[model samples]
Target: MNEKNTLLPRQLGDTHIRLLRIYKVVIESGGFAASEIELNISRPAISAAISELESLLKMKLCHRGRSGFAITDQGEKVYQSTLQLLGNLENFRSEMNAINTDLVGELNIGITDNLVTNEQQRLTRSLSTLKLRAPEVVINIRMISPNAIEAAVLDGQLHFGVVPELRSLSGLTYSSLYQERSQLYCSEEHPLFDKNNEAISDSTLCEYDAVIPNYPQPIKIKHQQKKLKSTATSTDREGLAFLILTGRFLGFLPVHFAQQWVAQNRLCSIDSHNRYFDTHFFTITRKGARENLILEAYLEELEKTL
Candidate 1:
């Protein structure tokens, strides 16, 4: 029997932690080549680190070859365990920082895209306030999907998340931020682009393929009596916009975000008045977690901005 195979989890050291972090980054980035910039390391270095990790565990973690990058079953298990371990480590750091009166440590926040263009969004104002009040605290913001935001908050990987309410999760708390308006959009090359809003009936609109968000549940569209065939799906605003711009699909996008495209004649709204929906955005945090003074102060600042 190999001596390393018998090593317990508690025996992991600083080297193991470093390797785990590298592994997490590679997986999150989707591939080793894609992770180079994020990890700020060479591809060879990353591969070496992964190999070291695999050796330490005495198991293969991933498959990287011409077929493309993929995580093995053991890799998935290790990845999940790493998340829990890192989350606990973060909680410990937060607890230690809370011992002092001064706000310090990092604040991880996740948000959905396209909010920067919305006039009603107060994220910048809240961030400014946080910086002024807590100069010692480091703030990190990640642009992610609503589902990812909720999951990160639940796992303690993110201190807070800003996302539209799709469905309620049991272990999370939500605070309303603002309402966002989304309208059906089509590219200039789309068949319905130059047509008058009234001329395009439901049956006519349904003729073209619909590009929808890749949410776990079906998205509810206002005044949509008939289901349009979903030909494509995207998890982010940028991807959805790209698909719509192909002129092959129709999709819903935030009005403010679609403004520039409309101005450039790249995209246009089908009917803003009748074919739009209001989505409520909220700030989510984990329930039953120890209250950190810094997080509380930041949340207070965010509420004031709202």
Candidate 2:
């Protein structure tokens, strides 16, 4: 019997790290062609890299025969270790590079309609500053809802989110950018405008037709009012603005969006008392990544525009 070859501990080399990355791609994809697609390398190159990795480890890292390619039990352990090593390596590089001014990654921002209506000026000003400070960094904006923004950011689909601070998110870092209030609005002819009797109860307001946005916060508050039987309406705030401008119906709107209209007499607040909805609008980012300089700078500029 051949004597078992003895192995000595050795430092992992750059070649080993590269091959580990290729191996990860192959295992994640299960096919050489798929790995090629993911790694942006040729299929032959992927196969060759896996062969090199197996030789370096002196063990079968992949069971890449007949039925679709699969990794062995040992391969699974290796893959886990590779992931940890790569993750740590990346964190190290990020920490080192983050000290300098070379901002080179894409920043994905999630924006909701309410943000568009209330904080558009502030956001645009922030972007303008970013463009001058970090021209290399790309910005991708996704328009989504205040309710869904939290999950999307947590899941890494978005780098950050901006929305009305209806409340705090348990796990997120929220920075209040500006204070905003929601204004109750109606056509000039709405009877809630009797103007003589000031305060009306929920039951009294329900006697007339009302339109509402289909968002969790609004829906929750509306449902809590036991006496109101509102004909629930679902539309983006832009559509809501259009409806209000046309004298069709009434609803609560971000004060900024309706301010000009109210000044021009196109829309009127339900009560002269200005029964406004008070909430802080905020910018949210994951706690860990907020330390990234590019993100921090962007947020700093955002605070200035508030």
Candidate 3:
């Protein structure tokens, strides 16, 4: 028997490889026209590739007519095998390149909207450095909640994420960036302004209708534990600020974000002498994925700034 034919299914030639790849594209895209858009190849080229593939195998691979395209029975079998074969080849390439160069590929990152605003500049600086150092690589940034970020990374939709230190999930690794402190705040003209801690107890604080922003509402882990009563919730910071300014309610704000308000005496921290609440910010990635140089280097860059 010829060596090529004797070699098992594991061994294949370049022609076979190309055919399998094109077949997969055709099947995934549902037809030649869609494949042209996805593969950025001409329609004639896709049709030609498919024709050659069927000729070599002596099999009719697809059903085509005026309506659309559908894969034949034999085509389905070939498609499954092709997926495995192409995946193995790609992994082999990744391993070989790992020995010689920086990780090169696209990375999608999910982050909370709060982190987007608070850390946008620092992140932009890091991304700028990555673009300069590795011009061939691409990165996509998205804003999502902590829970959604975890789910996306787990589902392979996102390579990594930045989120608050929340409940733990399996197969995830987190690195602490820094600790953020928070404090109860109200406009300087509020009734509790300059009042002692006793005067600002739960009962007294609950007397007035409290307004707190719903999203990006300034994470206060301790405040969440205490569970003070609130009459209304607002999603926009402006709404929360407006209510506080009007002396309708007392709310909590991050000491850092609320700095200017405190400086101008527009908002007063309930207890200047006591440290009140805090949360540790963190960056998370799939545990097994840090071996990727792109992810490793990106983490390194973020660490330098954070």
Candidate 4:
């Protein structure tokens, strides 16, 4: 090993973190090919990240060739060290999140439906980081309506509730987190799917059947919902999506949530540029509640993710 490679740099930076993360994923995934999907990178990129990590550490972390994929003894040790490092970093975050807060207890979080397609995946990723910080902590997640989540948080049934910023309730603190936009969509079998957006006037849109939400909606969302004839109604996004996919009705869905169908050409936006609404999302907690170390720790991890 070169003398320069024998010692770590004086200060570890983002580059080091990136390399270690790649290495950790590779090890956990068992091979480069297996890690490609999880890492969202190509085999070549995975190979390059591994090579870079090896060069930085001056050691062959794993054996990769036609023969087989296997982790070197040193690689196993480094992986363990990586876990320790992440845990330590989370410890600092938990402490900074609240004064004298212990990383113990449960975190009951409420979240709205159909946010999995979000590109950032900030919520799930932050929860993972929090789990690393407190392996023993019990984290419970509830998927329910925004209003239901609000009531739960206000009533102390939930420590954290994430909902769109339709309206804020008193006696609860809110933190801005995410913003999502929903556009009117129709499946390819619909009459308007092949038509140009410019050709689709409000009158033309109103001529077709549309699905409206049975749940409550904000003023802006309601205005958009009213643009089309309400021939159908759904209690949730999945039902609305089903109705839209049937090509008998048009409905509004989050862009990210509808991407898969759009990619398949089974769904397309209708006057998306004109008929869309953006929803700002927030995390809510009891405003004057007693201190909770678990919630504070999670918020800290989540803030870093944001």
| Arranged by lDDT, best first | 1, 4, 2, 3
Candidate 2 residue lDDT tens string, 1-306: 333343213577777777887887688667697656346789888889988877766778777667768888878998988877875664554465477668876677888775655644688888999889899887888876675577556544466788775767677888767766676677666665434227666666677666677655643345432333456566467767766655556677778888777777667776536345665667888666434666777887887775
Best-to-worst TM-score order: 1, 4, 2, 3
Q: Best candidate, TM-score-wise?
A: 1
The models' CA-based lDDT, in order, is: 0.82, 0.69, 0.68, 0.82
What does candidate 3 score in Cα RMSD to the true structure? 11.5
TM-score of 1: 0.76
Q: Cα lDDT of model 1 overall?
A: 0.82
- Which runs in model 2 stand beyond 4 Å of their true positions? 1-100, 116-121, 189-204, 218-228, 246-248
Task: Estimate, for each residue in 203-266, the C-alpha lDDT of model 1 and write its tens digit.
Answer: 7777889887765433565335235568888867788899999999988888889889989999
Residue lDDT tens for model 3, 51-159: 9888777788998879779999999998888767765554454454366476577767886654433433467777777777777767888775566677556544566
Kindly list the per-residue Cα lDDT of model 4 for residues 118-220, writing each as its tens digit.
8856898999999999987888888887876885576455789888877777888989888898988999999889553654778888899999988787898
Q: What's model 2's lDDT at 149?
A: 71
**Ten-residue region with minimum lDDT total, candidate 3:** 112-121
TM-score of each: 0.76, 0.60, 0.57, 0.66
